[model samples]
Target: MNDYIIRATAGNGAIRAFAATTKNTVEKARSLHNTSPVATAALGRLLTAAAMMGIMLKGEKDLLTLQIRGDGPLQGMVVSADSNAKVKGYVFNPYVEVPDKYEGKLDVSAAIGHGNLSVIKDIGLKEPYSGQIELISGEIAEDLTYYFAKSEQTPSAIGLGVLIDTDITVMAAGGFIIQLMPDASDEIAEKLEEKINRTPYVTSLLDMGYTPEDILKLILGDFDIEINEKKEVEFYCNCTRERVEKALISLGKEELEKIIEEDKKAQLHCHFCNKEYNFTENDLKEILKNAL
Candidate 1:
């Protein structure tokens, strides 16, 4: 099934929920970075959560970035998403691996030890809004839940998971975020917590061919849910040859001349997409002219 995200209001507008399936999107990132099993799981979860957060924006150009700095082998991770649901990300160490935590599941928590979770939201404003919280579990879901409760003062439950195939490709990936809105009653919050604790693994449900809507039904069965909007999500990078050229030009004419004199060509690689750009001596000379 094509990747998509759903936004809905449950419990008569007393709760806001979001669910997303990101199999294809995460697979794209795995292919681009050639990440190992552990890195694939870590990066995949962050990308899925970032896509859902992207949908929370109000304007077209709004963007969100999720950064995790941990002490484990994976070290750190960064994911970026825009209002259009276009997302991309990379890990500091894509080859880090660890033994399974339980039942042979990926040891994502071990790969990402205690650290910090930082979120930056740019909503076409003078200054982007930013927040930081100590990592709750080094697991993306728990960290996100902590952020919402501490930073936004919204009680929330977040579940994110990614299943990797034998070949290290993403098999199934998805997540759900449920928030208690204003006017939520204590009884409602308690019941909602019970439901969340009992719900099946989000990734397993997606692997069984459940759509985003079906996942929501499993979580908020008795409550009235209004589907607000839906949008396609993907792993898309906004890098191009033109942008690389502009970057080289900004290095100044003297620097370009130095590169031309020493090496016949220059090599540039994007950390996010892992695509390499080659610039011949002629290209360097042209960029030098643009610098002046």
Candidate 2:
């Protein structure tokens, strides 16, 4: 119940919502990638839809990534988020093992088969505004609702989930993202697509303890809400050790002198939080004298 995120607006604003519950930020990313219950329900539904699309960034060092490369056997995933929803990710086969798309469901679109779903963003951009598509149902919320209706043309309705618990942890992660505001009409987008086709699986209403403003008032309860902001999402990982010694001195000086002549000592790990960054051999000769 602590992980948060909420930002609202209803018919009066022609719908623009976002919700989140993220069971302790996907149980701290399934305890830092010990993932399995289907890679913790496919990286906990893309980390609860990148923490509600990272508070729908608008600066404050905005950033959002969300890659998913696919081709099955869980060969993809790489979330990131900021604008205060703080996230992190990893899972290019976190114990890949595909099976159940039936009895008790956990196939995450067959462990993410077909590929692509990149959506960069980066805001203080001098370039960062990428977008890609394809995976219409590798199922990270319908490839982010077809990447927000073809890469941000908006008109969306995403609902991710993540339940897994018979010991594998994360009892319920969360999600919801309902957009439609270009003077939304057409009878309020056909009554929010017939009340999100009759609600229910946002991790089964966060396992019945629903929050994120009660799942946006159970799907915009007759469009009258207008909350706006609440944020407090987590599982952050701003990796450090002085940002991995400035990324090993930006890999210059001949790749830090061939990692001090063939791995004299350099650990590096951080796939978003597997943490491990030990660089000895005098810390690669003081990071190659700060890379010359």
RMSD of each: 1.4, 15.1
Question: Model 1, stretches more than 4 Å misplaced?
Answer: none
Taking the candidates one at a time, how many backbone clashes does each contain?
Answer: 0, 0
Tell me each candidate's TM-score.
0.96, 0.37
Q: What is the lDDT of residue 159 in candidate 2?
A: 88
lDDT of all predictions, in order shown?
0.91, 0.86
- Tens digit of per-residue lDDT, candidate 2, span 1-292: 4888889999899888988888888888888888888888888789888878878888889888899898898889899988899888988888887778887788888888898889898898589989998897797897889888887788898988888888889887888899998889899899889999999888678778788798889789888998988988888887779988888888798978887888888988989889898989898898798679
lDDT (0-100) at residue 88 of candidate 2? 86
Clashing pairs in 2: none
The TM-score between candidate 1 and the true structure equals 0.96
lDDT of 1 by residue, 27-101 (tens): 999999989988999999999999999989889999999999999999999999999889999999998989988
Q: Model 1 misses residue 275 by how many Å?
A: 0.8
